[model samples]
Target: MSGLQPLGSVDICLVTMPFVDLCRPSIALGLLKSALKSSPYRVSVSYGNLLFAEKVGVERYGLQKFGRQTRLAGDWVFAQAAFPEHVTDTSDFAQQIAQDIRRLAGLDRDPETLNRLAELVLDLRDQATAFVDEMVESVLAQTPRIVACTSVFQQHTASLALLRKLKERDPELITIIGGANCTGVMGVANIESFPWIDVIFSGEADDQFAPLIDHLMRSGLAGLDAACLEGVITKTSAIQLRDVSGKDLPCAFVSDLVTSPQPDYEDYFTTLRQVSYRDQIVPGIPLESSRGCWWGHKCGCTFCGLNGHNMRYRAKRADQVLNEIRSLRQTYGIERIEFVDNILDMGFFDDLLPRLANEPRKFNIFFETKANLTRTQVGRLKAAGVGWIQPGIEALHDQMLKLMNKGTTNAINLQLLKYACEFGLRVIWHVLYRLPGEEDAWHGESAKLVPLLHHLMPPTNFVPVTVQRFSAYHDDPEKYGLKLQVAPGYLDIYPLDVERIGQLAYFFDSNLDYPSAHDRHDGFLALNKAIRDWKRAFANEDAPPILGMRDEGESIFILDTRACATERRFRLEGIQADVLRCCDPALRSERLAPVLAEHHGRRYTESAIAQAVEALRERRLLVEVSGKLLQLAVPGEIPDLPARSTFPGGIDAPPNLAALIGASAKTAVAA
Candidate 1:
C-alpha cells in the first residue's frame, strides 16, 4: 500500500447498463465514486443505461425494463451480442418473449401482434450489438485503467457485453464486476464462467473497494493476491474461494452505515440532460439510510433473497441522515427522494420522520416498511412528506401470511390500506399466490372479500411465488415440500450446463406439494376477475369510487359511491354513529362493547352494541375481519390520494382539494 500514486492519478470508470430504470441513478456506483474521492483514483461513471435507452427508443426500452424479471427478456436481448458463439439461434427466444409481451398486455391469443413483437425482438437484438459497441467507444474515450460494472436485475448481460468488447480492444484494461447479482455463489460462478471478469467483490465493498484500487495502482494485478483483498474473488482465487459444491466462502460485510459516503449523482443528471427523452423522466435521487432487514433477522420471508448473506440491520444516526438529506436537496435541487432500504428502520419513527416533517421544503419520499403499521404511524408518514410506500402486503389471508412467516394477519394488512388511503399515501403492493402449504380455498375466500374493499386501493397485480437463491425455500426445499430447478428463462439466456446455470441463476422454478395445478388455476380465477374489476373501477377518472365520512356535532354523514354500495348516502345518529367512532382504529368484537360503554359513560350490554355494529356492517359502513370491526370509510375532510396510475412519474404534488372531492360530497358534508 506504500508508495502509491498521488491523488487523482489513476483513472477508473464505473458503469450502469440497460434494463435499469431510466428515472434514477445507481446508488451503488454513486457511493463508489464518493468512496474513492480521497484515494489516488479519479472516477467517472458511464451512464450506459441512458445511452442505450436513447438508441433503442425510450418507450421500447421501458417495455423491456418493466417487463417481468422472471422472463429475463432484457438479458436475452443482450446475450446475443455478448456471447455470439453460444447464442446462435434466437427463434425460440423471440417466440417466448413475444408470448410474454402478449401476456403482459392482456391480449387475446392472436398471431398478428405476436408476429410483430417477434420481429421487433430481432431488431432490438441487432441494436443491442451496436449499442454495446457505442458504449465501449464512450468508455474507452476516458482512457481509464480499470472499468467496473454494477449488475442488478437485468443488467448482467449488458455489462458482460460491454466488458467483453472493452477487453477485446484493450487486453491490459482491468475488468471488475459487483452488485446484488454478484453475491455469494453467483459471484464465484461469474469469474469461473466468464473469462473477461478479472475481479468480483462478493459482498458490500464500501470498506474494501478503495483499498483494492490502491493495491492495483501500486503493485498492479501481478502483485495482487488473496491476502491483499479480503472479500474479493480474483480470477486466480476463484477456485480457492469456493467449497467442494462450488458455493461461496463466508465474506465480511460493512458493519456501520454511518461511515458510508454520500452518493455522487452529478454524472446521472449530466447524462440525463443530454438524452432526447429527458423531459419524460422526473428523476428521483436514490438514498440509503439503512441496510439489510430487521424483521428478516427475526423471521425472514420465505421467498426473499434481498439481503444475501447480510441480514443484520444497521442505520445511520438521525443527525447524519438529516444532514445528508439537506445536502442532497441543496445540491441536486430535486424534491423526489427514494430510500433504497430493504425495510425502514423502526427507530426512524422517533427521530428521522419528525425531523423531515418539520422541514420547510417538503420532499416526495418513498420507503418500504412492514405492513403491521398503526393508524398513527401512517399519518406520520404522510405528514413527513412520504407520499409513497411499499408496505409488503403480499397476501390477504392469515394462513398464507403464516406460510411466508410474515408475522402479520389479514386484518392488520387491511387496516394499513385503510389508513394509507385516509392519509393520501399511495401504496404499491401486489398479491402473491402459489405459496407452499396454502389451501386452494383461501383464494376463494379472498375473492369473496375483495368487493368489500372497492373504496381502497387495489393490488397492482398477482404473481406466483419464486424460489430465489439465499431464500429459506431455496436453501431447504425439502422443509417446505418443494423441488427446485433453474428457471426456464436462464436456459434461454445462458449457454452453460445445468449445474453452472444453477450457480449463476437467482430465480428458480419450483414444484409444491399442495394446490394441484388445476385447483390453483381454478381457485384464482374468481380472485383474478375481482382484482380486474377493482382496477377498472379505479381507472375511471370522472367518478371513481368514494366512501368517506364527515363528523358533525349531532350526526355523522356517510357518502358511498362504490359499485357495491347499498345506497348513495346514509346518516348515522345515536348509537350507530357512536359505534362507528369507537371503531376508528378497529377493535375486537369482545372489546367493542366495553369501549362503547366507556365512551358513553354508561354500562351497555354486548348484545345491544352487537346489534348496532351489525347494522353498520350491513350498510357497508363497517367490515369485520378476523373478529375485528374496522370502519371502511375514510374521513371526508381528507382529500383523495393519488394512485400510482395517476402519477406514473412518482411526483406526488399536493392534490387540489376542490378538484378531488368538491363535486362528489360538497352537498353531503358541508363545513
Candidate 2:
C-alpha cells in the first residue's frame, strides 16, 4: 500500500464541502496532502456527506410537494422501462426491492410504486462507504491516526455517521469535520450531539489543517486548543464563537484529491445510487474552478444558504486546467469531464473551450451557472461541446427575485434562456413556489412564469425548491421581518436560535412582521393554505371536476386546471370554483360543458365526458403510457404549423416585411 511506500503518514483525514456526489475531494484535501509528503506520518483521506433521516424528511417533503407529479411520473417511467441485461445480471431485482424498504426507513412510497429508486441510492451509499473504508484501512495499517470527513450536501451527515461506526471499530482513529456547512457552523460545539466528530474546523480547513495535524503528530493531542483553529469549536461551547482573527477563510484549498491518481477505480464500484449522467462524465479529472460566490454577498434571499452571495473567485490557469484534462484523457480512457465549480465563469469557459475544440479527442463537458448568460456565450459554449449548465432561477416575481437577489432581471433571464434554447444547449433551472409573497403576487408571477415556460421548456430541466435553512430571512429573521415559527416536527433539524449559523434556527413561534411596508403574512398564509388544500384535494377520491388545455404537439405536456380557475376568479365576477384531477373525462361535462359551450360553443357536462374518456382508457381507446405526457394511440390529427425561418442570428423578420424586399432585390427592381 502507498502508506508504507513513504509518501508521508496519514495523520489527518479531511472531507470537502457539499459532500454530495460532485464533491471535488481533490480540492479540499489536495494541498494538505501535498504538504504532508516526506513526513513520517502517513495520510489517508476520505470525504463524507452525512445523512440525517430527519433532514431528509424536511427536504423530501418539500420536494414531494414541488416535484411530486414529475418525479412520480419519472419513477413510473423508469420502472416500466425494462432493466438492461447488465443491470438485471448484477443483482436480483426482487431482493433489491426488499432492501429499499429497509434503507428508506419507511420513506413514503406506495407498494406498487417503483421502489428501485430507494434501492439504487442505498447501493451507491454502500459502495461509497466500502470504497472509502478500504482506502482508510490501507493507510491505517501503516499507523495513520486522523480521519477527516468533508461534505457538500446534507448527505455528509450520513458519511459522518459512517465514520463514527468506523471509529468504533478502531478507537485509535481521530475524526475531523470540515466543509461548507462545517465552515458556517463550526464555531459552536455539540460534541454530545455528535460524539464521533472531534476537532470540527468551521471555515476553510486548508492552511489550518496541516499545522493542526503537525501538532497532533508531534505532541499526540497536546496544545490542540491553543492551535490556530479559526472556526474550531470544541465540546466546551454551545455557540460558534468566531475567533479573534475576524477574517473569513479562503474560498477553496488546493488538494491531491485532484492530482493524485484517481482512486484505483478497479475497486471503484457503485450500486444503484442516484448517479445522474446530467454532466459529461470525464473518467478521471474534474475541475473546481472557483470558491464562494461573486454575487451572493449582499442579496441574501430568504431561503438561500448564501450560495451566490458569498462570492470568492480564483480561476486556475487555463493551460493548467487544459493540461489536467489532457492528462486524464491520455492516462485513462476518460472522455467526459465535469466542472464541479459553483458557477463556471464565462471568461474561463471562453478561454478553455476554444483550445479544447480542435483537440484530437473531443472532451464532453458540463457546468452550472446563474441565469442570463449572453447569446454570444451560449453560441461559444455550444461550439465548444459543452453539454449543459444548471442555474437557479428560483422564482419569477420581481419581488421574489429581489428577495432572492438572483442578480439578474426577468427580462434578461428570459433573453438568456432564449439564447440557450436557440443554441440547443440544455439548461436546468431551479424553481420555487409558495414562499413569502402575496397570494395574488404568486398567481401573477406564476402567470408570467407559465408563458415563459414555452420559452424555456425542459427535457431541458426543472428542480423545484421549498423553503430551507440559513437562507436570508431564516438566518436573520429580525432583519427580514419573517416571523412564522416552524412547528416542532420530524423535519426540524436545528433549533430555532438567533445565534446559530447552521440548520433551522431562525424560526418564529408567532407570525412576525417584515419591513412594515411589505408585511403580507396574511396573504402569504392564505396562499399557503390554498396550496396545501389543493394538494390534499388532488389526493382525495371525492373532489370536483377539472378542465385543462395542453399544447397537443409542441414538445410539451402540461397539467394545469388551476390556472383557468384562478384566471376566472380574478378576471370574472361571481364565480366560485374547485378544480381536481379526474380519472374520468366525463366529469368534465357538468362544469366544463357549460363553460366550454358558453366560451367555445359545444360540450356536455365535464363528468359525463370524463367518464367516457376513462372508459376508453380502460378499453385501450385512450392509452396512457406511465412515463409519457401524452395518452397514446388516441385517434387524432392536427395540421402542421407553418415552418418559421430564422434570420442569421435567430432574429425574427418583421411581419410586414416583404420577402422580396432585400438589398439585392431593390437593385434588381430599380434596374
- Go through the candidates in order and give each one's C-alpha lDDT: 0.81, 0.42
TM-scores of all predicted structures: 0.92, 0.55
Per residue, candidate 1 scores C-alpha lDDT tens digits across 1-671 of: 01111123238999999878888889999999998999867898888888887786676676574356787889988998788888555877787787877677665576755665666677778899988997887888778899999999899999999999999999999999998788878988898999988888878889989998888777668767745666688777777766734334635489999899999999888887877777877788889999989999888999898878569999999899888989988998877788989889988888999999999998878899999898889888988888889999999888888898988888888889889888988888999998888877788889888888887888988888888888999888999888899888888788799999999899998876334545446567888888899888977878978888998956999899998898999899977888888877778878877776777554667787889988998898887875688888888665667555333233212223223223223433453
lDDT of 2 at 344: 69
Regions more than 4 Å wrong, model 1: 1-10, 226-228, 244-250, 512-521, 643-671
Whole-model lDDT, model 1? 0.81
Deviation from native of the Cα of residue 326 in model 2, angstroms: 2.4
Q: For model 2, how does the per-residue alpha-carbon lDDT over 1-671 read when each residue is reduced to its tens digit?
A: 12122224545544432223322224455545655664666664442221111112112211112113212211111221111111222233323433433333334344322333333333433344343445445435545577776544343434444456557668767766666545443324234346666666665554566666777677745566666455555554433344422124222333322332222221111210222321311223454555455555444345665442244555566677777777656655555566766666667656877887767767666677777676577667766766566666665445656656677655455445545645655555654544454344554444433421332323222222333444555556666455645432211222224333223122223252332456554533443444444334433434321322232332222222332232211110111111112211222223544554565454545565566555534322232221111221101221111122211111111211122113224544576
